[model samples]
Target: MTGGGWRRTLPLMPASIPSASRENKKKIPYAWELVGWLWLAYFMNQADRQLYSVVQKQVQEALGLTDIQTGLVNTVLIAAMAVMMPIAGFLGDRLSRRRIILWSLLAWSVATMLTGFTGGLVSLIVIRSLATAVGEAFFVPAATALIGQYHVKTRGQALAFYQTAQYFGAVSCGAAGGWIAGQYGWKHSFWLFGGVGVVLVALMWRRLKDAPKTAAAIACSEPIGDVLRALFRTPTALVLTLALGCSTFVNMGCLAWAPTYLQLEPFNLTPARAGFFSMFYYQLFSFAGVLLGGRVSDKIVGRRPAFRVELSGVSLLLCVPTLYLMGATSTLWVVYAMLGAFGFFRGLYDSNIYASLFDVTAPRYHSSATGLMVGFSFAVGSLAPLALGAIKQSYALHTGISLLGVVYIIGSLALFIAARGFFPSDFLRNQQTVPTSPKL
Candidate 1:
């Protein structure tokens, strides 16, 4: 079917129809240039967010806020991101992806810089949560979609490279934020990271360029209603969205509170040590996992179309025991090993999360689909910080963290069901094109 015909029958068509119908463009080396800078952008993306968690103790003390309030700060940031996901996705489909990303980086950088000057809760909420999150929300859908456009054959590896920046950013910021806060002050940590981000904005503006348009890009400009209608109708997409929500629930809760947990009771580590331990062990192994999973998936995807979702499910199931033991055990060595194991599985899961979504989604609707999924996931998952915070207040931090295992279990089950049942049909559907009637 022609692109125009597919538009009319979009509800029945699979996501890859647009791209598959288009003539293959010559593979461009510019793909490398694109992912390179995007890696940096994502690094800053996560680092800026993770800083709040590392410095939450000091922020609470200085601001005279409670645990719930600290959680509220993260809640607000995530909520802002969630609210903007659809808007971001729509714009990404229509606008210059490079320009969207540059502006996003600039907006978030400015917000991060202003975060240094906050006087109280109101200022923090305005600068750190609202403004910064709005900027950050514009990034992922556009950037990921753009990368997909460039590296059709190398999608997994390119995305895996992008995923590594997340691990490094979280680890570095979590550790560095603690030390910076201890010595120079928490405000200075914001100033330092924010300043670097601003400098990168100038660099990205000069370096980054969007991919040349193709049938997929042209087709992607469909109205928002059409995009959403098609996306919502796909069972695989819906399942993945719920699965992502479950992943985020565990991730957001742990990222916000793990350092604080380590600083208390049995271990009693200093802020810097707690920060390092909380992220370093897990992310380090996660770093390796992305590399391993990406290569493995790329090699096997042709033979096993459902491998991405299957891998995600298996990884999450593996995380269940590790997450439970990480909190239940008092042995630091046991905790550390479990954290690494958890990170490995998570890395394996993370490597393919979006790639799996892309498999079932049309290239034209990539950004919008990403936005809907991310927005929904983040909105639902935003409750994690507050929910876990409240749980911690009522019970032990270990118990709060242990409860995350249950979320992982549910997510794992969803993915497994999708992998076994939904993926084959959906993937095969993308390969089938329905013919449109001749013009009257």
Candidate 2:
């Protein structure tokens, strides 16, 4: 494979399988099947994360926890994920990605189930923050890299399809958790989601198989320092990392507070209504944006490789006004409109993020690159919930939320810089590194 054309054959094969069987397997559309299974895992991953935010009020009242303490729960979880991401990325390159993903699903599900048993902040931090974070940190980089191996020509569309699970999970869990809390208790929501995750893990264990490693894959397993150096040397990757951090700051803050915000002010919604409204419009439009963005980018990217990055930059820039308006406005209808617009643009950016990064980095470095980008972004984002919590103490929550538009401005600018000045050279360098042997 090179810059001029896509590969006609699979890039990697299972070592244990014979050449005949490998070719037979390639004829089947198992890539989509992989996407299906991982979609379920990713759905559970997101739904579990959003449950705390959806039921924040109930949890806070039940445990006598203050705003800062509740904010600390999300902050610590992101922090732990950030700390573990690089190690997980390293392992993804060397070990069985299938095993890593399966184990991660099991570990996090168990921790989420145990969360129903927590009595106070300490146990919450231990189960929800540390244990769950450790589990989830292993899933994304490995899963994404695995997908990249399977679908080179349709990478953007496949990832975009996979990405929709995030919006669905957040929206569904937010609404369901709120209703469950109202009907029964916050604890049942946890147990229900966790049990579902465990079932998915068992199914995946039975069905998921690792891609056979190619000689190139085995040969390119560099030391951790080398992997880090390879990624940092690419200017576009660095800018993308910073861009991710900025966007994450806004996203994490909104996810943590938006439901509670709706429940309190001019909106004056019930808990279930607040949770549904907070997620429904934003994610629904976001779902549309990702699919459209993916199909457009895939159609044009062969001729305009940097189009993915450019699309991300443009989408982030477009989202700025809507994000600001969503927070500044008090009218419920206006807020919903802004949320939909903001989410659509966010989906456009999210659709191409990993695809854009993969375009600039060697295939061997995909997991490590994803890990570095995600870890740095999460570290930066971990401050958002805590910062918003502190800001709520001094001013209206909307004020803090409105100010997040500034971070988007900075991120969009960085992405524009990356697209224009650095992407061409970095992309060419990556294309040169990809092994062209037919056996691969």
lDDT of 1 by residue, 1-440 (tens): 11232121222222332342243453534567688899999999999989999988888999998889889999999998999987898889998998999999989988998998887898899899999999999999999998887766578889998999999999999888889998999999999999999999998887798776655555365677888888887889999999898888899998899899888889898989988899999999999999899889888776677788899999899999898998999988888898899999999999997888888877788889888889988998789999988988888888988889999999999998988778776766654532222222
> Model 1 Cα displacement at 39 (Å)?
0.3
Which residue pairs does candidate 2 place in steric collision?
13-212, 14-212
The number of the candidate with the highest TM-score is 2
| Candidate 1: segments with Cα more than 4 A from true spot | 1-28, 433-440
Cα lDDT of model 2 by residue, 127-211, tens digit: 9999999999999999998888777778999999999999999999978989998899989888998898999988888788777
Per-prediction TM-score, please? 0.91, 0.94
Cα deviation of 148, candidate 2, in Å: 0.3
Residue 222 accuracy (lDDT) in model 2 = 77
* Residue 366 in candidate 1, Cα distance off native in Å: 0.3
